[model samples]
Target: MSKNIDVLIIGAGAAGLICAITAAKRGRKTLIIDHANKAGKKILMSGGGRCNFTNYFIEYERYLSLNKHFFKSALARYTQWDFIALVEKHGIPYHEKTLGQLFCNNKSKDILNMLLNECKSLGVEILLNTKVNKIRKNEIEKGFNTKTAIGDIKCQSLVIATGALSIPSMGATGFGYEVARQFNLKVTETKAGLVPFIMPKKWLHHFGDLAGTSVNSQVSCNKHQFKESILITHKGLSGPAILQASSYWSTGDYIEIDLLPEKNAENWLKQMKIDKGDTLLSNILSLVLTKKFASKIVSLWFHNKPMKQLSEEDIQYIAEKLKCWKVWPEKTEGYKTAEVTVGGVDTHAISSKTMEVKSVPGLFFIGEVLDVTGHLGGFNFQWAWASGFVCGEVA
Candidate 1:
């Protein structure tokens, strides 16, 4: 059995759903296919089920792409406000979380339902639990023939929005990259982003005791810094600050953490020595960090010394260490626990405006499948909406 579609979208994800709705609204016969039983699995689980649909403050700087300016065109064309308006049209109640992140007041399912409803209203067809067995592009006809478990699908415009390899349990796969490769498109090296860092055995041994402890800190790596709460885990470190820094972190890279971002450690130490010389170093540190974490640090660094026992030189050294607490991550938690994928289909090979392959006219790639990755906030979702919207307009 064969069916012809004006636009065939692989992967009924955030990007694919938006693309289908946008194109179908333009009177195109759009069909979205996914291997999963349901669409928008990621959306259903994002932001602890509330779904950080988009960020209030979105800019090109917030995204990481081989071509840094590639996202500007699409993002500007379909701004966050546009999606916000769509949410309002659906009458979904949402609130802004910290750092301009927006989440639904009820559940993530509301966002998914809204997108599905939009697609339904536009007469978009979605095929769930349909796995694509093969895809071939016809040179003469200038179209694509995709064989799936259900049947053969032919389309004038083919879009690969299969997403990236993140959260495999939720059905994330590298099918998008495979499709890009089949079309001779360049795919950059891919890695996990917004993931937790796994500390080396030695470092883990020292800090592992502080598992479940969280502190407000400024964590920096590769010139990128995030000031948020860092959580100490049994495996290594996690939380907003660590997760943000993990995007910029490479293996063997040292991340510096300002344990007390509010205070100049050296100055504060000097003042403390003058005023409360009898106090133990751990006790003073406890004011800023958790008691267990403070005690562990003092035990390892200062040999459990009292403030009065330390000389000026020792005090300065201690203060400097506190200001620049460095930890070398052995590796990231990988795609299994990553919030997104860092690298993907090379943007240089695709048109930034339409997300269409420059060489393959009717083929397009968008969302996490592309090299564009956003920061820890809702920027990723914004990229999905923007790129999908742009591609739908043209493809």
Candidate 2:
């Protein structure tokens, strides 16, 4: 005998769980399936376990999409304030981090618990460790027929919230992209966003040992810019500013890092030369930037010359390097460590209002599966909430 559900949600991450709760609250029989035994594994590990759940800055410009306006409807329908209200209702204490990112004061488990509790109150059925064998549509009625390791199930609506390929350790896969292709939807060029850059081996020899060293700098790619902490890793760079710029960066792209963001390089150097005329260049830079970076820049620009012996040309060159140090990254680390995939199901094929396929009735795409992908911090989770909320309301 075939089991029946009003809506069958694939994947048990943020989007699927939220959609299930919302649908069940409206008296729909909802079943969410995931191969993993536990739900929200990604959520459990996000934001250092406390979870950066949403961002205060959620303008469309913060997202990268094939059709940028496609996210407007859902985001407008379910704003960050709506999620804040739910958090307040659950009594989950949260606080805003820098740049309007909101994180739980406790742990990420509190978030998963709240979502699961909502599902239970709404009577949503959750199936775990379930392998889906197949998914097909009924020719006559246009309903979905899905066969899982447990059994076969039929549904009037099928919501694909499988997310994207990011943290493979959390079971992220290409299933969502595969499903989109199956329905004849155009999938855009996908790449790892919010991931680290891999410096060339030669430069790694020069910079990799500087791991754990961080600097406050202005990072720029093309015309986009971010003023945040930049960290040096064993392999390359990883930090708020670098991750933010990585989303807009591509192969062979030159990234400009302003080593001294607080003051004009030339003016600061002139002041330093006048005030601390006897101070070594390396020693003066050590006070403002990481000691290792200070040493490295001194090595590159000063040619082992003494600070007192510095020429006008040398001073000007150092100023330029300090103000605008440019490096063309060899390549990004890719989706294996990416926080979100850059592209997915084309927005042109999906309705901006309901997130439903224009041609394929009873089918929906939300969260990281759709064309929209948000910037670092909590914007991606906000998209998950917004898109899931809309799909749940209409599905």
Candidate 3:
């Protein structure tokens, strides 16, 4: 005989787990399952294991989507304040790290435990290491018939919270996109977001030895910019600023980096020439940047000329190069190191209020499976929570 459930949520990640708890609280017979050995793998590994649960300043503007306003409804309904309340209620100690990002004071496991406890208290059963092979729409039962390893299960509402194609080593797959196609939903172009950039060999050859060096810089591309510390990796650049700018970069685009974000590098260089400080250009730059990096810049660009030898026009050109140094990324490091996928099931095919398929009844999609992708920080988790909350209420 087939098992009957009111709600069947696929993938026991952040979105699925929260949805299951919400449905069970509504007196719905809910069962959440995942192919992995444990639930909330991403959550446990997020924020360097501290888990940035949500941002203090949650706004729809911080998110990117085919339809920008598609995320506003659900986010407005289940705001970050709502999630923070739940954390406080559960006695999970958390603190804001930076940029309004809230991370657990202890570890990410605390957040996972809290979600699991909520599910347990609500009587929601979570099945681990369970792979779902097939799903068939059931017009007769007005629901879905899903084929799992154990047996066939019938559910009134089916939710696809399977996430997207990032972190493949963690078992990330395009299964969610497959499901959307099975239902004939339009899926937008998918790409890696919030990822590092691998510069060309020529560029790396100039600064490859500077690997492990971190400098606070402003990276910009396509009218978008981020000011943060960028780390010089062996292959290219990797850091919060680079990751943020990578989201807006396309294949053939060039990114600009400001070596000095706080002050005007060009004006400082001009002052050095006017004052006739007998200091080498590199040595003068060393006051702001590292001595080695300053030496490298001088060697590559101007050949270590002294302030007395360089004219005001020469210094101006050098300053312009430092302020607007252009870089063409060979390519993104891809989904392996990416924090999130850029696009998925097109938001136009989804109802923003309920996260349900507009043409298909009793079927819903939420979290990273959808086209909405947030900027770095706690915005992504907030999206998962908001979308999952609204969908659970209806599903």
In model 2, the runs with Cα more than 4 Å from the true position are 303-312
lDDT value, candidate 3, whole model:
0.91
What lDDT tens digits, residue by residue, belong to model 2 across residues 1-395? 47888999999999998888878878899999998889999899899899999988888889889796899999999999998899899999999988999999999999999999999888888889987778898778777998999899999999998888888878888888887888898999888989999888988888887899999999999899989989999889999899999988989899999988888888788777778777889988988997888898787667645456667787888889888989878898887788889988999999998889998899999899887888888999999999998999878
Candidate 3 local Cα displacement, residue 77, angstroms: 0.9
**Tens-place lDDT digits, model 1, residues 49-166:** 9999999999778899889899999999999999999999999999998989999999999999999999988999999999999999978888999999999999999999999999
- Alpha-carbon lDDT, every model: 0.92, 0.88, 0.91
Per-residue CA lDDT of model 3 for 1-395, tens digit only, reads 46899999998999998888878888999999889999999999999999999999997778999898999999999999999999999999999999999999999999999999999999999989988999999988699999998789999999999999999888688999999999999899999999999989998999999998888899999999899988889989999999999888889999999998998877877787778568888888888888888888889888687787887778778878888889999999999999999999999989999999999999999999999999999999999999999999989
Clashes by residue pair, model 2: none
| Candidate 3 off by > 4 Å | 274-276
Poorest lDDT segment (10 consecutive residues) of candidate 1 = 301-310
Q: Considering every candidate listed, which one attains the maximal lDDT? A: 1
Q: Model 1 Cα displacement at 373 (Å)?
A: 0.8
C-alpha lDDT of candidate 1 relative to the true structure: 0.92
